[model samples]
Target chain A: EPEVTQTPSHQVTQMGQEVILRCVPISNHLYFYWYRQILGQKVEFLVSFYNNEISEKSEIFDDQFSVERPDGSNFTLKIRSTKLEDSAMYFCNSASDGETQYFGPGTRLLVL
Target chain B: SQQGEEDPQALSIQEGENATMNCSYKTSINNLQWYRQNSGRGLVHLILIRSNEREKHSGRLRVTLDTSKKSSSLLITASRAADTASYFCATDLRRGGADGLTFGKGTHLIIQP
Candidate 1:
């Protein structure tokens, strides 16, 4: 079965530095999303992207956060300035339809 | 928040036994999906039940939805030791086309050998 793939399975960055997490969604999927989970916590929705635009975002997706679909398969999430609290596991998900999203293995972002 | 709440934060059962986890949501949803996650890993989609559908099944997993009561249940029958994992229920709300799923805290299930 085709699955979503993400690059840089684990990343370590210093506070105030920039970071970019990349994902390659399933080829035929149309909708993409980014979610994060703090250690031992529930997953939280960050943003949704479709048609090269952001559909919706949460408060955690503030000014420092941005997403881009620079190519047909590559979707990226960039953080302008990383904070200590930004440490978490970031997941990328995609779906052909609006329901039944498939999640990637996830990228663990640790900011010191 | 659109997030759902799951009952019995954790469950322990012997191999070959059955395990049932319950989920409750506050808002109306378009569909509800169940996902499983092994420790320190990503989520694996298990089964989904639409708002209009009351029950769905796949393999040993049985899912039931009660839109009227805003609750759902997931039953894993005759589970094996490998069935140990965290189970979560996610709610997909009706919000045009810009909505992502809201996930509950999840239930940690351990099937003893």
Candidate 2:
């Protein structure tokens, strides 16, 4: 089965530095999303992208966060400045429509 | 606020036994999905039940939705040791465009062989 794929399975960055997480969604998928899970917490939605635009975002997806579909296959989430609290497991998901999302292995971001 | 809340945070059973997990949601949803996660890994999609559907099944897995009560349940019959993992329920609210799913804290299940 085709699955979503993400790069840099784990990343360590300094606080206040910029970080970009990349994902390649399933080729035929039309909708993409980013979610994060803090240790011992529920998965939290960050943002959704479709048609090269953001559909919706949560409070956690504030000024520091931006998503881009720079190419047909690559979707990226960039954080302008990393905070300690921003450290978490970031997941990328895709779906043909918007109902069932297939998730990637996730990128663990650790900011010190 | 979390949209889905699962009860009985953890469970343990023998390999041949059955496992049941329950979920409650606070809002009307277009569909509800169940996912399983092995430790330190990504979530794997298990099943999805639309609001209009009352029951669905896939192999040994059975999912039931009670929209009127805003509750859902996932049942795994005759589970194996590999079934040990965290199970989460996610809600997709119809009004949101492609905003993605809201997940619960999840139920940690241990199936001992």
lDDT of each residue in A29-50, candidate 2, tens digit only: 9999999999888889999998
For candidate 2, lDDT tens digit of each residue in B1-113? Answer: 45799977999999999999999999999999999999989999999999999999999999999999999999999999999999999999974379779899999999999
What tens digits encode model 1's per-residue C-alpha lDDT throughout B6-62?
A: 887999999999999999999889899999999978899999888999999999999
Q: In angstroms, give how far residue A47 of model 2 lies from its true place.
A: 0.4
Give the distance in Å from residue B109's predicted Cα in candidate 2 to where it truly belongs.
0.3
Instruction: Report, for every candidate in turn, its global Cα lDDT versus the true structure.
Output: 0.93, 0.94
Count of backbone collisions within predicted model 2: 0
Per-candidate RMSD vs. true structure?
A: 1.2, 1.1
**In terms of lDDT, which candidate is strongest?**
2
DockQ of the candidate models in sequence? 0.78, 0.78
Q: TM-score per candidate, in order?
A: 0.98, 0.98
